[model samples]
Target: MARKLPSRTTSDDTKSARTRERILDSTAAVLSRKGYSETRLTDVAEEAELQSPAIYYYFKSREELIEEVMWAGIAHMREHVEGVLAALPPETSAMDRILAAAEAHLRFSLSVSSYTTAAIRNSGQMPERIRERHEAERAKYGRVWRKLFKDAADDGELRDGVDLLTVRMLVIGSLNWAAEWWTPRTSKIDNVVEQARQLISNGIAK
Candidate 1:
């Protein structure tokens, strides 16, 4: 057989994909800092180090870019945290899985990706249309936590009479809140993760 070479079109497509990802990443970081109301295409262009017009090549408008960023925020975190949980051994205890998930959520929100931080920071400020569009993603993440809680209850890890919904609210709400104030200067990320793990474990320990 004759040797074949890569197509020029394939190379161009790869570059285009990278550029699109760069735009989304820049938008996420900008959303974390400036928020939805203040983010501009020019701001993202500067952050991505691309010409202002280059952004439109990937996203049609500010609203479109923000929508993608918002979607990426929750979607990535949910995927990542679920992936973490899924990797545990089949015999792993439900409470251990839950603690791993809590750590994963805290780390992702605080340091892993600006995307999740942006999501946590602007949960309620997204336009109604965008919120409606991404609502499924937020709900999917909610379901992950919900299932973990349900598993704990089924496995007898949760304290008797504990309300899964209320404890779920406390745990998820506290983990999300860490995105707002956690910093390397304030505490080691590991320390924060450890403390959060303890809180979740203690709150639900039977």
Candidate 2:
């Protein structure tokens, strides 16, 4: 008789998926606290409350786990930005749309999730291959902002002779840097958003 293949039920698959998500969540938490070099599979496993070897079921190595965590953050941020842009009223001005996008980006970056903060702070320490992969995802994320700025410039909303690329970089760099110093107790997200909006709009508004 031929050997029979093992089978998995819906409940089994659901449990497996949940476990994987838990592992990823724990990975993000550990990375945010301990960083890449100090973080180990054992730390993630302890955080996840599973044996260290169990992590292998979800990821091959520590680097792979960290890469996945970073990718998840990028994906979530992209979806949020796209949704915010899509929800704007059809009659909204280009500058308004840009400000709205900035607000959304800043809000999400400051939220409870530390995935984005960890990724931004520790990307330089990632291995060469993993860093390249993360950068590829970041490049794709940059295109969204590029299009937003390009559309505004094309619509004559931006000041004459403005370099769209430089404007995009400065705006994004400012937002990303908030991961380092922004705190809810000292500065409100709304206040930061308005300040950024005023800065960008003043510089580029026609």
Collision count for each candidate, in order: 0, 0
Q: Which 10 successive residues of model 1 have the least lDDT summed?
A: 127-136
lDDT of residue 88 for candidate 1:
96
Q: List the residue pairs that clash in candidate 1.
A: none
lDDT tens string, model 2, 1-206? 99966666877999999999999999888887888899999888999999999999889888899999887777778788889999988998888888888888888878756778777768778888887667887888898898889889889999999998888999999988887788888788888888988998898898
TM-score for candidate 1, residues paired by index: 0.95
Candidate 2 segments whose C-alpha is farther than 4 A from its true place: 1-8
My TM-score estimates for the predictions, one after another, are 0.95, 0.90
After TM-score superposition, the amount by which residue 148's alpha carbon in candidate 2 deviates from its true location, in angstroms, is: 0.8
Residue 84 C-alpha lDDT in model 2: 92
lDDT of 1 at 22: 92
Tens digit of lDDT per residue, candidate 1, span 79-189?
999999989999999999999998988888888899889888987898787786578899998999999989989989989889989989988889888888888899999
lDDT of 2 at 20: 98
Q: What clash pairs does model 2 have? A: none
Task: List runs of model 1 lying over 4 Å from the truth.
Answer: 1-5
